[model samples]
Target: MTTPVQLYVYDLSNGLAKRLSLSLTGKQIDGIWHTSVVVFGREIFYGQGILETRPGQSHHGKPLHMIDIGETAIDEDTFNEYLAEISQHYTADKYHLLDFNCNSFTNDVIGFLTGGSIPSWIKDLPSDFLSTPFGAALRPTIDNMFRRPIPGAAPTPATLQPSPAATQAAVNASPNPALAASLLQAVASQAFSPSASVNGTGSSAPAPATQPQTSSSTSTVSAPVHICTNPSSFHSLLRSHRAVIAMFTSATCGPCRMIEPVFEDLAWSKTHGVGKDRVAFVKIDMGVGLGSQVASEFSVRVTPTFLFLLDEQKTYEFKGADSSELRSQTDLLLFQAFPPHPHTKLSFPAVEALSSEPILFTQVPALDSVISKLASFVDGSSSPSETVAAKEKLSQSFPVYLKARFPANKGAQPPKNLSANPQLIASWAEATRTIASVLPAAQLFPLVDLWRLSLLDQPIATWCSAATSQTNPVHIFMSKAIDALHTADMSARNTVLVTLRLLANATSNTALVRSLLSAAGHRAETTKVLVSSLLHADASVRTAAASLAFNVAAYLQKGRMDRLRGDSSAAGMEVEEDGDWEVELVSAVLEALSNETHSEEVGTSFRAAA
Candidate 1:
């Protein structure tokens, strides 16, 4: 799997670059000039002055150091937005020669990403200058340069980097006493600076400082409490979440309005502490047309009534504007939900984005040519006999080919040179798509065996950027395919699990993620199947499930924060309840991670993911 975190460091001539005027003529400076964080090799996260973290392009110098900060908990969208929020103060327009520069931005980003920061030297560079006699004398010139954005740099009003949702870095350093002592001595030796002793990258000398300097991570955003107008929809919300506190009141009721703000605040998704469940707080205006009917259904006769629902069933109800009673019932709601899931909680954005980038099919004939062979079955222009024969031929021959290619021989391997066969991983994906497009469970099952074989392992189950195939027909048809798999024979069921596992790791494209999300109508049941498969009796199936857990968790962490901030584009995303499929999936993963009875690989994976 690709590393989720990397350090993109750039040295502006190590204190002797284009801004030399500020360094030499203005203030004495030490260490490098700029640095940034890169996540999933997909985006460059750095402070550029003003608010815009340069999108995907990297104009900065080659990274001097690329540290693997393990898999990050936050996704790119969240990190980017965090940068946007941080610009409130860390604007490029306010760039300081020594004080708040690119270094500070990097520190803040590291904090957000891994709950760590660069060593003190990198962070306290300005402090170093301020402490010196000459530093105080040159403050004006340095501050002037900082206040003035470099001519070619970001225009005024650009800013970024914020502190939020963080914990101490989990980077593991070797436990060598000498190394530890030397590191302490090194810090002591650098007596000039007490603010920070780690290297510019937060690495300790004579030792790779794997431990990221700790920093506070608190997100300033979360999904707002929503309004429910429809009665059935509100009931569904109650049933769907672990705890839902519905505020029932009419427009004519004064207490409802008085308690409105408080309800909104309490309903907010962020509770400011670890694992606090964000209750579903909803308001029902009974004075409206549907309110009275809803009131009758819930048997509410009083104004300012609060209904505490646990698992779609109401366990408690409060009447009147007594805020104390309302809060007490909410507390009872949490108490029943119980167990207090700290980190291993339902994060819906992560659930929604649990997909690999689809491998874009950019090649022309390579992609189309393969589909050409099977497209005939879909169009029905071919004679029924021809179609039947083609299916049988594929069913019989493809699996044999896969077995030969991957070889059951444990020590056997695919050719050093790649396959030129049409079933080369590239053509296989096209074939899978063609079969899926051909439609009808009866027709597709014939080839499911072959498809399943392709997913077994090795050089078989995979794809390459074979053509301009951005969309996977399988992804689009996944729901139906999964539904079909459920009723199929044991082999077919196993095959689907294996194929999904392969897809999770095999493609570099997001087509899979897109398909899963777009077909969200089917996600609940589908998620259930996958989560259940994690504990299947089949060892291979369990292995596949575990791998998928990693992928799902990684993908989820990348996009969660943005979704929580109520990004309009992510409007309908909802966190699953305690027993919900998504919640079960996360809990299963966390359990597997903590389960010492399991294999080392699973335990290690969960620990890393954590």
Candidate 2:
């Protein structure tokens, strides 16, 4: 038979030592050497020692002596006390002792505790542990000792590993053999702690011996939290449970004036939990103000931008406005803030849908005209076929006309009074009424054309301005227009590519433009189309397509990687589960277009029919 070697009690915590005593027998004997006991705590040290017995003594020898291997005096009395306690508890009958002689104190202790046997391999070790397998190998042995029975006791039944809750409780309890054994059993059965208890109980274990909390008030905040001023902070706030709102506005924004009352109402409602926990509405003025730096950090270019933040971070944003629309938006945001019940249907007034049909204008009127000449033209056209065709053409061209004719105060300064003009209000109402009248007939055509036109350079400002009106008709028209424009046809698709280009070049509509690209169906094109568009004559079209394609590809890759992460066999699993790598396709196209060998810059503008 192989000679017995030195014993190791590796990685022994108080709970683990107690568990070993309760579970094992014949663990202590003369001539056995105990070495390398790794204790994970404030102090990290090792001990070298030997257990000696008389030469003629049999396995049942009465006398045993512990000799320190190191030159320094060993605390033999303390060591003997611990051994006697373990021996009396564990009931080790006959065992041979060996002198301690090993590089690692931990390995020796583990070897002794686990019957001087070592497994051929250890599996699934953490990276740090794998770097030093000896330490890692001992963890399982210590773990196994807690799972077994002593010599005279009934063998512990084979069972699943202890649950996190049970293990935590065991670790937290005072070091008593019986208590440790009970805790280990509880952990194994997964009945250690209740869900609420687990969350409420601070860390995995009860407060350690060194640190104890008498009450909730005694606990100190972990860190000094600081608010972020960028888009990342905005996202973080949205995800936070804390109630707060980050309002972004400019001093001279007209729409901001119209919506100020609504914000005040929101703030008031929050105080009563009418909004719950009373929202912390932090106003960040985009104009010259203390928050101007924050606005600049987030690249804020538009005024009246209301960022609905939670916990002082941005969650949702609102810019420009119609009173009813803004009110409805505010209500929806409030609903999100409160959430009646998990299963309850969320309630908020529905905003008007986007329009699909284009407004036909046979005659171009002055910029300030109150009445729409197109309405009379549609009513009076003589030929039925001609009228229908002209109406269809007008529907197509109206968006373009609106885009081209929208006014811009290029050299004018910002308006002093940030309030809506009565004339502007009247014009919006009239325009809405005129557009609503034609919506039913316009539904027959694809709404993509209307959207395409609205995105055009001149029409974008007009569309935005008109859509910002609270008039029901105008809201309805803009909503229907947006709906129609949601999906694109072949020609309209190219026009969209062009529209993106124009918006990117203009730079004023940064937020609006980003929202458009984020909408559905925008990332569905083939790589060829995307790459080809990169060299298109229009600068706006090329840049927009390129940026969008990159973003889409990045989003897809991230989503795929995230999906592949939790499972054990994820490494061998295929990356594309559905075989639709839309992002990858776009990326390939971008790569091809960007390669100077394959493509060149084309200087033509995109001009597909609306």
Candidate 3:
């Protein structure tokens, strides 16, 4: 449902001078009042800021004007946290008579909450009041009026409001795994809180998406907003995030600076509401961030220019600094790009509530002995010698230093730091990184299979942070498997491919696969590996490759491979007309379908790919 944010306009002067002030300046008088933002009908940050001056007297005795600033991208919990962060800057100490006051604080809150600034005149009233010689003379009196000491009272900011730019991290790391994940899921799915416990062991079966999302909460990107302060990042942004709002601004432009608050307000301060997928807001200061030639490539001569793009195609273009219109049109652009999911009808309350209850992977991880034994065979040097007898003894005793002990419950306590995997996962990645060159081609696939199982046992939350990382064991193992998929031994090749297929089924998540492929630092190459594996001689390997392809295609269906679709050459590979390897992979699946009619298993996998 569309939940419009509430904006409160309080008239401090109560219209007493509106009739008189209009005659003085010939401008319409809207009364002198305080402005504030109220979410869900309660004002937590403001109103109290202005209470010292107005008390019970200057309410205007009128119904506070409420302006709907479109649907909120924040939930109540996150909204409360965000209020706290801005409150640091909007403290009572920061209030000024002619510079920063109630109106300024309200504008800040409104911008933070809904990414829409309050009315310009409201925000400028104090400055406008001071500009007048009469009001300038009265500034001291007004300041004294607001600065009056409260009788036996404390400060408001000392008590309420703040965001740490880390709500996602908090949610991901909640003590109650279900609660934290439900909180995030609530933003998108609006699901109710879930149970803390999960049942069943891990298998080559897809875990439920709405289970206790505790495992995956271990990973998080601090903030979604990427400040595009330069050209290279801007170019990269163009290729990623299916839906992007590019606020083209300049340092010297007055209006651009004016609406820059809008950038601060609407940026990724919040990532809930209708949809978080493929939606990104980027601020490109064209003057400083993009050079003149590069700016011309985007054809930006004007400041405050906005480009609304979906799937790399421009959907809307406009030049304006009007914060409201900019926001409304951006909302419209998000609507055009990502329409509301059909699930918004409120018909499935049970299902909506269940969206937070993710079933975690509870299967026991592989024993250290298995990993140690697997490492033993592949730990040998590339050139063998009579010293093999001595080397075998050392390899036998070699322990797998990169083994982690996963908890039965993902949200049990302090979550494991896959990002800061200084030992186990890092050692695993190092072993996989050089193992291919060290081990014979025939044995590489079996070694990779063991590595895959070791990683597969890791909770999805361990590897899938909100960042692109290859240092994690899951990524390194996949990178190693990319080599194993092409080994000369059909048995080893099929084993590695089948293991990938099994892992894909075990966790039907896009973040895991994307993170794995993201390890190689190039999506096209990893994609090529998945596609090239389809041409393997063994039908089962090809089928497993196809199954892996099918699994990843589900990731594509969700727009996870935004990196694969870009302007760069495909590392000298053949480019399709549209230049998406995703298309080529799909075509390969179809071709395999035509040639292979015998195996029911391969056909079923191909059908899933189709």
TM-score winner between 2 and 3, please give it.
3
User: Across residues 1-610, which tens digit of lDDT does each residue of candidate 1 receive?
Assistant: 2337665555545333233322121223444445556664443332333222232234443555665655666666665565544444343233443544555455545555665555554544544433322233333433332232233233222211111111000001111213322332332122111121223353333311121111111111112343443454465445445777778876456676677666756654233222233346666656542456667899999888988877778898878788777767766676666544355466668535544332121111222233344444455644354454544444445554655555656688766653333234444455455445445543443344344334334223212211222323234334444564466445445445544554454333232232232222224534654565555555555555666566655555434543434332222222222245556677776765554464666555444444
Index of the highest-lDDT prediction: 3
Q: List lDDT for all candidates, in order.
A: 0.45, 0.33, 0.46
lDDT of 2 at 585: 52
Q: On residues 1-610, what C-alpha lDDT tens digit does candidate 3 reach at each position? A: 3346666666544454364333222223566655545555454323233221121222223335767766666677765554443332333333333444555445545554555566766654544443332233333433333331442122232222112332333323222233322322321111011112112231223212221111111111112344443344455555646778777765466776677666545653322323343567765545432234345778878888888788877887888788887788777776776665554444856433322221122343454555455456644454344333333442342223223343445655434553323233334444444554455545554454444444344332233322223333334445555666655445456445645554454334333343334322335545655676676767766767766766655544434222223211111111112345557777888888877766888877776667
Q: What is the C-alpha RMSD, rounded to one decimal, of candidate 2?
A: 29.3
Candidate with top TM-score is 3
lDDT by residue (tens digit), candidate 2, 1-610: 1222222222212234333321121011111122222211111112111122222121222212321222212243443443333222111111101111221222322322231222212111111221121212223433443332332221233432444544432232112224435633532332111111011223332211112211221111111111222233334333433655555655456666566566655554343333222344544444321245567665666776655555544566656755565556656666666655442344433311212122121222242221233435455544355444544444444443443444344454434433222343234334434444553424322222333323333223222322222332223333443332443233333334433333333222322221222212122322334445554454544545555444433333433433323221222111223344444554555453544242243211111100
lDDT of 2 at 364: 25
Q: For candidate 3, what is the lDDT?
A: 0.46
Error of 1 at 363 (Å): 21
Q: Residue 415, candidate 2: how far off, in angstroms? A: 2.2
Candidate 2's TM-score: 0.22
**How close is every model to the real structure, measured as TM-score?**
0.27, 0.22, 0.38
Q: List residue ranges in candidate 2 displaced over 4 A.
A: 1-409, 417-514, 517-585, 591-600, 603-610
Least lDDT summed over 10 consecutive residues: which range in candidate 3?
188-197
